[model samples]
Target: MMNMITDMKFLNFFKITACLVGIGVATSACAAGSSVLKIEEEKKVPKIQTIKKRDTASVAILGDSLAVGLYIGLTHLARKNEKLKVQKYSRVNTGLVRYDRYDWSKAAKKISQTDDSNIYILMFGANDLQSIRENSKAYHFQSKGWVKHYNERIDEITNAVKKPGREVFWVGLPIVGKSNFADGYQYLNDMFRARAKLNGITYIDSWDWFANSNGKFQMSGETADGKKRLLRAKDKVHFTPAGYADLGVRVAKEMQISN
Candidate 1:
């Protein structure tokens, strides 16, 4: 009878050990499955990409009366963007031709040395339709000598503003109300364009922007909001406040700072 009791006790102990081993195996399998599922879920997640924003532009506007108008317009447009900064260095009745009154090449060199601006906008040729004196010799407008000297002046101004990280933009004259003035301006625009290209500087042409469908001058034009407004002053050479604002919009677009 003792032998029978011993056999029964051994059988019961064996069954308990087998049951414990099965439970441990089941637990280990569940943990392994959960680990694999977690790894797969991690793989399915998308990676996030970062995008960079454009840098701010510090603009310096230098020219004649038209540049003054451009400064006003850019100021108004820049009011909305804190990243854009514009400074005007324009004078009335001043241009590249008359060194006796104001030397733009000297002024540009001075600005380049003193200012921290990255962009320079040059608008002249309004008061430059006159004669240019060199070595006490007069070179009349449209003369070969005058053209050569004017082109050299353009180069001087362009080189003055063009630094290691600076950009230069030469703004061409727009159409005037008087046909004679308009023709003169067209001649000047060609020179400005050629010189700008030769110097690797950008030239902003304002002729077509202010002209009618027939390529003639127009007094009224559409603004940014698509409304017709008087763009030119009564003098027909300079821009009205609204006209300048429109020009500002176009320039801002070129600078890639437009809202």
Candidate 2:
């Protein structure tokens, strides 16, 4: 009887040990599964932040028609990127400060904010190249110091946008086909580069990639996004949706800004 009882106790102890072992196996399996899930969860990249932090980044555009809406609806899409709050400060047929004293005065009065944290992206020279000499809108160029005034005006405009700590990106003029106007474009691009270096700003050279083998304004096939490059319409001066998206991609890449 005693031996039988001892045998029963031994079996009971074995059964208890088996139960503990099973529990440990289940616990270990659950832990391993949880670890794998956590690793997978960490891999996704977030595109936009719905809730803004205390510090908000603001960008403003200061250019001519390009800023006013020249390309593949790019500016609008860029503004809706679910990331940036982009504000365009473009005036058609207008540069940094128009040669017209009255227009410039009115433009200056319209200004309200000038903070360094405010980023400004500027492209100009399309209109300033036009001769508005002494109230003559039709005159292309008879002024003697046109280059000098244009350069100085661009400098002043750049400095104004600087806002002490504000970031500035000045996109250079593109190469154009058959537009003797491109000479002015090249001169303006050179000036922009010099001024950017002087003020420690980023000078984006659109002319480099936008130029064709003939050294004129040409689209690189379709923009990186499969959109055809015809957004400039027949004018080939502005961007199509595809074109702007392509430009936006380049801009985002340069600035390391999110989409």
Each candidate structure's count of clashing pairs: 0, 8
Compute each candidate's TM-score over C-alphas.
0.77, 0.64
Compare the candidates by lDDT and give the number of the best one. 1
Off by over 4 Å in 2: 1-56, 70-80, 96-98, 101-117, 132-144, 213-216, 226-228
lDDT of 1 by residue, 62-163 (tens): 999888889999998888888889998988888888888898999989998998787888998888888999999999999999999999998898888887
Candidate 1 regions off by >4 Å? 1-55
Name the top TM-score candidate.
1
* Clashing residue pairs, backbone N/CA/C < 3 A, model 2: 71-239, 72-239, 72-240, 72-241, 116-166, 175-217, 176-217, 231-240
Q: List the residue pairs that clash in candidate 1.
A: none
Q: After superposition, how far is residue 171 of candidate 2 from its true place, in Å?
A: 1.2
Per-residue lDDT value at 223 in model 1: 73
Per-residue error (Å), model 2, residue 68: 1.7
Instruction: Give candidate 1's error at residue 89 in angstroms.
Output: 1.1
